[model samples]
Target: MLVLKKVQGGESGLEATDLELVQRCLSGEQEAFAEIVARYKKLIYSVVYNIINDKQEVNDAAQEVFLRIYKSLDRYNPEYKFSTWSAKIATNLCLDILRKKKLDHVPIEEIKEVSSRLDTPEDEYINKEKSSIINQAVSELPDKYRIPIVLFHQNGLSYEEITEILKEPMSIVKNRLYRARLILREKLMPRRKEEVL
Candidate 1:
């Protein structure tokens, strides 16, 4: 059995690298694969939720992503970062789900509010409203623009990693991200003005 002991202030406090976990998992240690799920479940959920935008579908899609990951472990390349590879799988799966369902206008109200210290309930409400507006704008974005922005900003993937996952040229990834930002700015500017007024 592969055991992971907790340590302070390091990557999930697990001593084993992702490759090590995968190796152990391949060696028939089920716990190692469980550990991998525990480590990355939040990430997979975030990627799926951002794309699928429906809370009901997010859970099913995330579960399916993990199942796919487990089945494809043998094809995992040691040269690449495991998180990147797994994110690519999640992204592709979510996209496939979207294509199959032909979903339109999914609401994004389920997006978690970013917590911060607020001096008053009014401030908290304002913050949440702003976040909701932002998420709404993001959800309205075209998929070509939305996917790159979500992977880059929301998921914190690097341009190179996104390029790899998206199989687009570096210039295309950068361009899409830039255009997404511009579109978001345009979408949010009127809201900002209304608040000021």
Candidate 2:
């Protein structure tokens, strides 16, 4: 893997630098490509895992996402932010995998198992249960709602970016996000009330 960029004396930094790395990668710097992969791996992983809950599938899907991005880098438009463009690629790959597999629900036990190593046993169990419940509810949502929820809240994409990614209008993105929150609230509220009672 390529070394992550190092800031030298008087150099602004990677955050201040825009598409220079993309340009370098395009100009045949192998390290630049590795830097791109390293930079976006976590974001890509989060995007993939939010849609596909299986750990093995998540790793496979994430690798597939990077491969696709590498192959398609030449076609990348510098007009958009690199992170946004890459995130769109990640989201689409995840959606394609989910559609092909026809996964209907996220297994709650998988969520629990993934977080088994908590500092305290009681806290770990409680957090795991809560995560499982939330994930299950999210998994139950229809694709239209679920996609927006994951893209916006989980992945931190703006409605405009999501609009471009999903190829939907801004209004549609807004409506989906709004409705997703309402649905999650309706689903969780009763459970919360029961816990109190």
Best-fitting candidate, scored by lDDT: 1
lDDT of 1 by residue, 93-171 (tens): 9889888988653334334455665447887777777778888888888888989888888888999899889999999
TM-score of each predicted structure versus truth: 0.87, 0.82
By summed lDDT, which 10 consecutive residues of candidate 1 come out lowest?
1-10
Clashing pairs in 1: none
Query: Model 1, residue 154: displacement in angstroms?
Result: 1.2
lDDT for every model? 0.83, 0.77
Over the stretch 60-161, how does candidate 2's per-residue lDDT look in tens digits?
A: 888998888878888888888888888889888877877898876543223344544544878877777777788888888888898888888777788888
Best by TM-score: 1
